[model samples]
Target: MLCATFSQIEIRGKKGRTVPVLLTSEIESNIDLLLQHREMAGIHPENLYLLPRSNFNSKEPIRSTDVLRKYGKEANLCKAENITSTKLRKHIATISQVLNLSRHDLETMAEFMGHDIDIHRSIYRLPQETIQVVKMGRLLSAFDNGTIVQYRGLDEITNYLRFKGGLLTLVL
Candidate 1:
């Protein structure tokens, strides 16, 4: 017998625009954990797995308004007068910086936080010495085949590569 690893379906908005929402393996594992917790709580094995309510107000079908009230309180923070999604996004960005995330990690976090990766990179990516090194590498690698001369040392090789004008054609 064979088993499948996992699968995903692409989600689209009402306008038919594809959303960049991709679930990691962690999500499926967390759902399995939730199911295990539900079974431990004495929910019937047959009914052990069930979707949360659209409003997610209860662990079970209870009429208590406490969960709803809590949700309302949290929602009030994003209310027009108090805070905006933009503000919340800025807070998350700051937290990402404080945590010292790398560029790839920041991209993942931005996706998790429902922000544009380009915007996150623009705001959070610091200019580092590695960027200059990469630029220099590109500059050195742009020479013609004839321009690549054998040299005694790495510095001489680098200088020969960086040499411009008729020096490159003369080597041919």
Candidate 2:
């Protein structure tokens, strides 16, 4: 399907969920190359699957885990064995959370990711200690500056974090 400028391909994922995958130009070119190679090799024009097995008649899905791990080793990514679909999904979930979308927008994102908000956060959105430290520092700084929100009872905390104690130690 078409979206904005890039192409979006919808496919059935686990549990019959509809998953939309966007193809960048580089990935599109790679797919084109594969199709060209398949055509040159005299593969059946009516092949039912995109990444058909070497047998050509098997209905099995391509093993992207093996491909990703091999590519990771060649590209010097983290441990090759760690390259996996779940890792990629978790990365997308966790990274998208950093954009600070609204609750409604997050729900839309969760829908697009084929999961509900609770499952998305609990299963994929892993907590990073460094990120937590940075966010806490920023929150404390905002409170200290009285820029985030003005709450009556939070004044004590704000006053305490206004560089008086070691409560707010942000170098950013």
Candidate 3:
């Protein structure tokens, strides 16, 4: 993360892109609490980082691993050791399937994750069950909304969704 204002996060991204993403209300509230805590603790308000390194002399943001480990321990959450930056990114990529995002949306997500879409699709390969659920969920959603009439037959739909743990070109 690069910087922050009251409303948004400015990412000095890994891919050399600087993007300002607005925070959700819930996350914004958490940030407010953090700001308040920082203020009470005499953290200078002028510091640029949203999650600053504890060392006052350092300009670097707090490490992702440090944040994960600290929160995991404080929350008494099991397997916090398993929570990592890569795992968090993969979780975002995987859980986003339930949203049935369009190609453009997926591209945006990949970019946000500091990669190209091809890498996202290939490297973030989800489990077979997750893939199956997403594909079937799409089919069911289409059918429920009467878009299934666009297809000539069930075979076509089945073939369209036959994602053998690889790219399945979406059709409607």
Candidate 4:
């Protein structure tokens, strides 16, 4: 388990899954500077976890307040002088933008920053129309392959198809 102020990260096997993280107010204080800058770019702190690199230096481990303070100075944010967690969040937010972190990267950052999984998904994982198409394609493929063993009901099938944006017509 890799522990940071924002979150506790546990990396599993090659095809492993990430565990849920609990974000506390204490971790929020550490990234205050970054959050401030993110808000300026129309990105909310609640959505900060969506970015790949929320912190100024993604390569370094920001597990301590002293490290945060030192980084702030190097970034010319003077975080220690400011003393507001909000300020620190904003500063980090600004750096994140400068670094051009991607959405996938943001998810990793969210994990690193100790944001809850739900919060991370809500902000970054917007629903898309294409998802339906993909599902429909898979269903059709399964049908062709004779892999669809037992479908529950018309409504259940339709609902499943609807995910792929498909409309069902009961021929029976």
Candidate 5:
């Protein structure tokens, strides 16, 4: 996986929902470096594990929650409360709504987040303040300029977004 041009991991979250998460370039590089360090740490190919325990079988991962918490703390530069994985997931979800994604893109993103599209909309979409401050501002501007339309669904909103707000074009 380290030598590959791209890498992705399928994370089975709660409720048996699986999400294929693509690694960014920076994260991929870190993974490659980690694997190299793992080899240096005497974790042989016969018993391969990225985060292998020193005296335990290599087949099992080091499942200590503290490891996640440690990284969560480091990443929480703002010193926010309860910087857990769930917070990270929700942060990704809330911000993603403003991308003005097309219907297919939204579905793909929702599936990649290990939830149904409806769930994504109902629970993960940005709050009203964010929408009102950002997206709705653009909508209001377009409406004032007589460039808006009367659309009923997300797809129509996406079309309107294309001409008003810059839209996100996801390839993966």
Candidate 6:
């Protein structure tokens, strides 16, 4: 999109839900530069669509297929695989698993992702293999350090360590 403002965005998400999104500082700067260039190029501000149709009289948005071809060729990615917006979505989801966000942060992310908390937990959470490997490594480290506690269910540990308001105070 050529002229999208990056401060904040309100998008119609999956199932027509209105989702609010805020941009990072880097993205905001980039969008500001792009908008300034567009103004210098004499592109009229009356057109509201970020990716406007080429025809002056047309109000429709630019076709996605046209954008795909241009983007692929410019990035030299057309030969590797079919690159689409869907790939970008999955890429973000995959990398997000590594972030150590609180429960409230996870819920906010789920809303931005256009899904309920349950769907986010079941689908976007780290893969079982990754989780097991990381946890196993931590357990081994604790054992080696002689700090390992007796094996008990996660519920018992969480209940014992959780703050009075049910917030998890343990990190790791």
**Top candidate when judged by lDDT against the true structure:** 3
Using all chains and alpha carbons, the TM-scores for the candidates as numbered come to: 0.29, 0.64, 0.57, 0.25, 0.56, 0.53
Q: Which is the better candidate, 2 or 6, if ranked by TM-score?
A: 2
In each prediction, how many residue pairs overlap at the backbone (N, C-alpha, C within less than 3 A)? Answer: 0, 0, 0, 28, 0, 0
The TM-score ranking, best first, is 2, 3, 5, 6, 1, 4
Per-candidate local distance difference test: 0.52, 0.69, 0.72, 0.50, 0.67, 0.63
For candidate 2, give the lDDT of residue 94.
Answer: 84
Residues 64-102, candidate 5, lDDT per residue (tens digit)?
A: 466776776778756635666677778887877777677
- Rank order (by lDDT, best first): 3, 2, 5, 6, 1, 4
Give candidate 6 misplaced runs (Cα > 4 Å): 1-6, 24-47, 63-69, 78-82, 133-172
User: Candidate 4 lDDT, tens digit per residue, 1-172?
Assistant: 3354346435332235454545666766655766557656455344425332345434333344565567767778744567444455444543443233566776576555445446655544423444445446655766778765454344324455433345443221
Best by TM-score: 2
Query: Candidate 6 has which clashing residue pairs, if any?
Result: none
Higher-lDDT candidate of 1 and 3: 3
Superposed model 1: Cα runs more than 4 Å off: 1-80, 123-172
Output the worst ten-in-a-row residue range by lDDT, candidate 5. Answer: 163-172
lDDT of 1 by residue, 1-172 (tens): 1124444434443355444544457777886787668645555444422543323334444222555546657777555343444556676776455344567888777866656788777775546554444435443564444344443234423433434664542121
Evaluate model 5: give its lDDT: 0.67
Q: Which runs of model 4 end up more than 4 angstroms from their true locations?
A: 1-114, 150-158, 161-172
lDDT of 4: 0.50
Q: Lowest-scoring 10 consecutive residues by lDDT in candidate 3?
A: 1-10
Worst 10 residues of 6 by lDDT: 151-160
**In candidate 2, where is summed lDDT lowest over 10 consecutive residues?**
151-160
Q: What is the lDDT of residue 132 in candidate 3?
A: 70
Model 4 scores a TM of 0.25
